[model samples]
Target: MDRIRIGLVGIGKIARDQHLPALNQGGDFDLAATASRNGRVDGVEAHETVDALIAARPDIAAISLCTPPAGRFEQAMAAIAAGRHVMLEKPPAATVSEAEALAEAARAKGVTLFATWHSREAAEVDAARGWLADKAIRAVRIMWREDIRQWHPGQDWILAPGGFGVFDPGINALSIATRILPDPLVVLSAELAIPENRACPIAATIAMRCGTAPVAVDFDFLQTGDQTWDIEVDTDAGTLYLRNGGSRLELPGAEPMQGPNAEYPRLYARFAELIRNGESDVDLRPLRLVADAFLTGQPTPAPAFEF
Candidate 1:
């Protein structure tokens, strides 16, 4: 009961890059094992699937899902079915319906579940929320531009039918924006620039509203030059800046605040807390916003993209 033995279900890039280090840092958990079809962490017991991992290590108290959203539903349900706690990465699943179903299933099974928005745990993001609490927000602008090839070179699933291309990164911005803003922003109008050869959009422009305030978001997958990940909100007081994917915050009159690059570490800590407390944290507002955008969005055809 002192340390929960957890199994990592996906050993892809994010697992090796972030989760492995965070799990090893001691936060009420012991990295019990790993399951993956393609990759794995060294020195950990590896299995080909969560089912296999469960069969081998029946003592794993929890299962962390680091796989892409497209396959998250089945894997997570399998873990919950086995009466194990579940932790999911951002966006939860490919569709809002699936995410909701998984949450309901976890609740019915009496197991704790977590759908984490890692960016919300950023220290600078916390600062921004504190500052915005006293300010009257008006308008917001978000530019989340990055090179897909550089970030997801061979992840062909990103362009598949249920894949969320630009939204994969843009949802991180939405997570922070929704966390720090004064009110909830709902999607109004959206334009998705879909490639002729792909199923998902490579770029998107969205207009949203929070009461009378207008919010604009631009998500692009072709910014190979200077990658920009910034959010600016113009309030009655002054403009507030949460830049570098919420690692830096700038208020009207305060110094730029920075935090250690430990977004994943903080995510793991929160997951452990929820599991220990016998509670579930499954907030789907960000994913619901994405779903609304898709439902109300108009498609704008772009040049054919092979990759």
Candidate 2:
């Protein structure tokens, strides 16, 4: 099959670090253009806005959006209207309604819409899911903590109302958990630590349930030293550990299974497959869990933070 000419929106760190590399890895996509305010790719056609890119490149049949979730709904809508398949970054939109609207619009336009959870593509994620499919889950714990200065740097949008703050990364854990756990998660309680000067939470402790199993999540954006992105699940058989953002998995009485970071590459592969099959993959379970946390969470004031 011919390569799908694709344009990338948002040339930020994620685009440069992940999307660009995956697109250049000689897969089913051709990097045709990019749209960003200040960032640009080395030889690709660049535009300052998605509208301009859409108008200028009619040959681009797909748009992969890595932009912040705040205003992504309009961009996705425009692309879907133009008959281009759209791939959205995790936490697809600022609100569940926006994400749902995009999905409905894409379906009406008969275009593929992929709301990608890149963490679900981590090396051992699928294996972990397969292994847990039949196990009786007893309990689960998710610890996703990292320094915002080290990862997001001075990106103040994270503290903005729609940026999702800690949930931006916390949702990755939820994505993996939702994928591997057999039952659906229901957020029972959440304690959110909001910076005195910010609109979003800097840390959150969420208590949830998956069937009879209790799930606990600890999310923080101010960790300094060694970062932690780990999930531990206790089952009737034994314990399962997915560490390093799901790239490494450790099972009871067995050696760890680890693999290189291929999340973005695998995500692109799935997008290509969906486009070819005339289907859309817009799993909103993880996002819904985040939304539930926000809805039921009790806010507490924390010290003001700065990067």
Residue 173's lDDT in candidate 2? 96
lDDT of each: 0.90, 0.95
The digit string of per-residue lDDT tens for model 1 on 1-307 reads: 5888999988887787888889888877899899999887788899999889988888999999999999889999999999999999887999999999999999999999999998888779988888889788889999999999888887888878888988998999999888988888999999999998898999999999976889999999989988899999999999999888898888888788888788988888888888878899999989999999899999999998764
Off by over 4 Å in 2: none
Worst 10 residues of 1 by lDDT: 154-163
TM-score per candidate: 0.97, 0.99
- Compared with the true structure, model 1 gives a TM-score of 0.97
Estimate, for each residue in 1-307, the C-alpha lDDT of model 2 and write its tens digit: 9999999999998888899989989999999999999999998999999999999999999999999999898899999999999999988999999999999999999999999999999999999999999999999999999999998989999899999999999999999999999999999999999999999999999999999999999999999999999999999999999999999999999999999999999999999999999999999999999999999999999999888
Residue pairs of candidate 1 with colliding backbone atoms: none
